[model samples]
Target: MTKEIAVLGAGSWGSVLASVLDENGSHVRLWSYNEKQVAQFNETHTNPKYIKNYTFSESITAYHDLAAAIDGVDYILFVVPTQVTRSVARQVAAILKDRNHSVNIIHASKGIEEKTYLRLSQVLSEEIDPENRQSISVLSGPSQAEDVVTHDITLVTVASDNQRAASEIQDLFMNNYFRVYTSDDVIGVEFGAALKNIIALGAGALYGLGYKDNAKAALMTRGLAEISRLGTSFGANPLTFIGLSGVGDIIVTATSTNSRNWRAGNELGRGESLEAVIKNMGMVIEGVATTRAAYELSKKRGVEMPITSAIYHVLYDGADIKETINQLMTREGRSEIG
Candidate 1:
C-alpha cells in the first residue's frame, strides 16, 4: 500500500526525509510555513537554501496550506524545530478536528521544551486531540540530512509506545541506503535524541578551542555517562544509552560539521557571539535551547550534569570558555562509573 504522507517543516531534514519517502514509493506532501519557500519548491523542484544543488523527488509536492497538507495524508511527519512544535501541532490538530481524520504522528525534530521541559512527543500529545491522533512515534539516530540525501548509508531508530506504529514506521522508512530499527523505549529514544545535542555543543566547543582527539573522545565518553544518569532518573532504560539513539547519535552530532548545535558551539569557541553565530547559521540550533532546558532540568531533578552546566554557563551566563573548562577540570574527581 502506498501511503500518503504529509511532511511538515521544509527545512533541510524535512526536505531530505520527504525525498527519501518519495524514493521509497510513498506520496509525500511537504508543508512549509513560508509561502515563498513553497512556491520555490513547486517552481524549481528544489530547496536551494537548505539542501543546496539537490532536486526533490517528483512524487513530492509542496504545500503552504496547513489544511491542504493534512487533507488526505495517513501520516504526518513533523521536522520543525522543537520550540515551534506547539504552535504547529495546534494548527495540525485544528485541521484534523475539522476533517475528523486520525493519523499517526511522527516527529524527527529534537529538543526538550524550555519551560515545561516536555519531550517533543509530549508536546504533540498535549496539543493534538486524542481522537485525531492515532499514535505518536519518533525517528532519531546519527543520520544527517546532507549525508542521507547523497545516498550515504544511514541508520536510525524508530520508537513508540505502540509497537505496531513503530514497526510501521520502520517499514515505511527502511530502504537500500537507509535502515530503521524499532524500539519500544520511547522515553529513552527521545531523551537520547534531545540530550545528545547538548553534549555535541560541548564537543564542538572543545574542537573550536583547539582541543585534540583525546579531549573530544573524553568529552563524548563522559558525556554519555551523564546522559545515561539523567535519562535513567526519568525512567529510561540505561541500556538504551549504549544504543543508536545514545552513543550513535552523540558520535555523529559531536563530530560532524553538519550538526547545527556543533556549528554553533564551534563558532562560540572561535570567539563569535551567540547572536552572531545564530544569525550566521541561518538555522535553528537545537542545542542552544536544549542546553538551557537541560541545565534547569538537572537542577530540578537533582541530577549531576557538570558538562551540561558548564556549557550552559558559557552559552547563557557569559562565562569565558577557557574559565569554564578550567572549572570543569578542577571539580572534585569521582569514580568513572558512579
Candidate 2:
C-alpha cells in the first residue's frame, strides 16, 4: 500500500527525506512556511536556496498550508529549526485535535531548548494531544544533506520508546543507499546528535586555526567523553554513545566540510563576527544556538564539558579563540579518565 507522509520544513533535509520517501513509494507533501518557496518547489522542482546541485522529486507535492499538507497523513516528520518547534507543534496540535486517526510524530531537528531546556519531542508531547498521536520518535545521525542527496550510502538511527514505532519508521526510510537502525535510547540519540554539533564547531575552529590531525583527533576523543558524561548524567545508557547517534555522528560532523556548524566555526576561527558568518551562510547554524543551550545545560546539571564551555564563551561571551585554546591547555592537569 502506498503511504502518505507529511514532511514539515522545506529545507535541505526535508527535501532530501521527502525524496527518499518518494523513492520508497510514499506520497510526500513537503511543507514550508514560505509561500514563494512552496510555489518554486511545485513549479520548477528545484531548491537551490537551501541546497544546490539537486532537483526536488516532482512526485512529491509542496505545500504552504500546514493543515492541508498534513491532512490524512500517517506520519509527520519535523525538520524545522528547534527554536520554532514549539509554535509549529501548537499549530499541529490544534489541527490534530479534531482528527480521529492518530499520526506518528518524528523529528530530525537536534537541540535542547535554550530557555526551557525541553527536547523537541518533549515540546511535541506537551503541545500535541496524546490521543491524537501514536508515538514520538527522532531520526538522527551524521547525515549532511549535501551527501545524502547525492545517494552516498548513509546510515541513521530512528529511536522511539515504542519498538513498533521505531521499526515502522525504519521500514519507511530504508533503501539501498539509506539504511535505518532502531534504538530505544531517545535521550542518548538526541543528546548525542545535539552535542556533536558543538564539538564540530570546536573541530572547525581547530581546522581554521591551521591545527593538524593531532588536534582534531584529541578534540574528537575528548568531545566524545564530554558527550557521554553529560548524556549518562541524564539516565541515558553509556553504550548508546558508541552507536550511530554518538561516535559515528561525531566522526562525520566534526570532520566533514559539508557541515554548516563546521563552516560557521571555520569562519569564526578566521575572526569573522558571528553575525557575518550567519548572514553569509544564509541558514540556521544549529550549533550556534546549541552552544548557548548546552553551556547552560552543563552548568545546570554540573557536567564538566570544557570544549562546550570554551566554544560557548567564544560564541556567546566574545572570547578570543586562541586565548580560549591556551586557557584550555593550561588548565590544571587531571586524570585521563576524568
lDDT winner among the candidates?
1
Lowest lDDT block of 10, candidate 1:
52-61
Of the candidates shown, which would achieve the greatest TM-score relative to the real structure?
1
Q: Can you list the residue pairs that collide in candidate 2?
A: none
Model 2: ten consecutive residues of lowest lDDT: 93-102
Count the clashes in each prediction. 0, 0
What does candidate 1's lDDT look like per residue over 165-210, in tens digits? Answer: 9999998999999999998888899999999999999988998999
RMSD of 2: 0.9
TM-score of each: 0.99, 0.98
Error of 1 at 173 (Å): 0.3
Count steric clashes of candidate 2.
Answer: 0
Tell me how many residue pairs clash in candidate 1.
0
- Residue 124 error for model 2, in Å? 1.0
